[model samples]
Every structure is written in structure tokens, then in C-alpha cells.
Target: MERGKGSPGKAPRVRAILAGGLVLGVGAAITLAAWNDSDFAQGTFTAGSFNLQGSTNGTTFTENPVGSPATLGFTTNPANLSPGDVVTAPFAVRLDGASTYDATVTLSTEASTGSLAGLTYELTQSEDFGCAETVTETLVTAGQTLGSTPASVTFDLAQGAGTDPGAPVNLCFRVTAGAVVQAQTGSTTWEFAAQSQ
Candidate 1:
């Protein structure tokens, strides 16, 4: 039945429905315009670093270099076998970067012949340069038995809070032949590794 001028229970006309749709469309467009907006924001980012390096000798503290057989032999070709001989080598470690870092130094050992029998070693530490105050000297009696284990030291080579970079810590390694060492030829290697936390 057509809904038009009051036949019985009549409803709105087509023109009235079209007018309501037009009003709803206009209202929607006005609401959309009110909510439209724009804004501007900005941010920045940067990076940091912690670089560690070391050296075998003082003048060339670049990276640790292994001692050749010719150097560690401490004697001429086919080095003499004996006891009570002490060999000392000086080394230095540094943080070569623009930031401060908390780090640890550990020692590792290996043997190429006879497993370094009948030998004893000592490691001592001191401040070489740029230490704000004296760091207490440390001595560790790393005997011949500590092979391949990372023996951590009591002292830490901390990069001080000050803005100085390229500061070095000096270490003296003393190796002594045991009094009762056997008359045999052997070789051993030791390494120091530094890690940041």
C-alpha cells in the first residue's frame, strides 16, 4: 500500500524522506570539517661505542702480539735448559674510544710442549698514565697448573668518569723457572682478554 496523504495508518511522503537525507549529509560534512586538524613533531637519535685494545710492549700498545719462540727463548738457538731464571715482560691495555666503560681483564693459557711443567708465573698491575689516583697494585700467583681457564683479576681497568680517552694500564708479567724443573724443551702461551659490561 502506498504511504501518502492519510489513508489509514499513513507514513511520511517521499519528499520528506529526501529532505531528511539532505540534512544528514550536510551535518556529516560539517562534523568532518570540525575534526580535521594537523600537527608537527620532531626527534633525534645518536650512537655510542666501547672500544678496547692492548699491546705487548709499552711503545707499541696497539694490539697484543704473541711472543715468538726466538724472543721467549731468552737464549741462543736450542736454548739452554735450566732453573731459577726469571723473565719479565711489560704490557699495557687501554680503552680507545670517546665513552666510559666498565670492563674486566682475564688471563688464558696454553701449552705447545710438555704443558709448561715446573714453571711459576706472577702478574702485577700499575697505573701508567691518566689515572686520577693510584690504583692498588695486584699480584696473582698463577702457577703452571691454571691452563685454559679465564682467571679474573681483583682489580678492574675502569674508564674514569673524566673525559679523557686513550688511557693505559701497565702490567708486568714475571715468569720463573721452578727450582726442580726437568731438563727438557717446552713452550707456553698466555693471553689477556678484556670485556665490557
Candidate 2:
């Protein structure tokens, strides 16, 4: 028996048809697939400003930076001291106009010089700029020794609305000289540290 030449040609044609059908099937599957898209998100951040200022006369507020402190204008002469003498001074503090958050002000003694023996002090919150005899609130207890800072003497300051400065907190410091107080020059420096809340 002789093999027919037509059989070989038919097999090649069948293979070519099978291969073309496979390619078309693959192309149709890709075209029928679902369409897709994507989205993204982002954010921006910034920091707010904060500042604290103080005033001795309550009219002109400024930042009393370290090394150059504001001198308190005592009602009595601090240079000339006498027994049973009491001197008082007024101070005011507030958050500056640019501040964006409220804060807490803590009072502490930063430095002391000369002889502070036989001297005591008292601190109070006053209703007005003048350290009046009537006390609105007691911040530091009476009879605290000179050059000594009381623990937990703190006050709160609110942030102002818009560009205006916050309301001022008036403070009064009263110092007394005892009978044993000597004729020596002495000075005490107090610090008002503010923390934003």
C-alpha cells in the first residue's frame, strides 16, 4: 500500500487552523476583560506660632528675654531697707497677638544675690494693675523666705480671638523685712515660663 500525499497536506492545514483559532480565542478573552482605574489622596500640614510677653506698667507689653530682664518698679525704695518694711510691685503677663494656643505660666526663682536673710515675700493675683490692699487671689503663701521659690505657683493664659492680644493677668509681689534684716544689698530674679496647651 502507498501513502497518500493529500493526507500530509491536510494534516498541516488542520494544524494551521487550530493555531489561528487559539490566537483568536486569546485576543477575545483580553478584549472582554473588565476596565480599571485608580485614585490617590494627599494632605498638607503646618505648625502654629506661640509667644509670651510681659509688662511692668501693664500698658507696654514686650518680651523680657534672658540676661536683660525687666526691672520691677517697687512702690517703696528697695535700696534703703528698714525693719518692719513692706514693699509691693505689680506685673502683668499675656499671650501675644500671634499666639495660636493657650498656655500655662509657671513662676520660679532663677537667681538670687547677696544676703536675703530675714526677708520674706508674698504673691497674689490682683484685680487691677495696681497692687491694691484687697487681694483677689493668693498665688504664693505669705511668709515665704527671700530668694526661695514656692512649688506649684502657676497661672493660665487664654488665646485671643483674631489678631488681638490675650487678656493680661495682673500679679502683685509683696516683700517684708524682719527685725533681723541687715543693711546689705540683695536682689532676686524670678522667671515666668510659659507652656502651650
Best by TM-score: 2
The TM-score, computed over Cα atoms with residue i paired to residue i, of candidate 2 is 0.87
* Candidate 2 global lDDT: 0.89
Instruction: Score every model by TM-score.
Output: 0.61, 0.87
Model 2 CA lDDT for position 16: 94
lDDT of 1 by residue, 87-141 (tens): 6666667776554676676666644555466666666676663222243475566
Please give the CA lDDT of all the candidate structures: 0.58, 0.89
The residue pairs found clashing in candidate 1 are none
List candidate 2 segments past 4 Å from native: 1-8, 25-36, 180-182
Candidate 2 positional error at 114, Å: 0.9
| lDDT, residue 120, candidate 2 | 92
lDDT of 2 by residue, 63-120 (tens): 9986988899999997787889899999999999999999999999999999887889
CA-only RMSD, every prediction = 6.6, 2.7
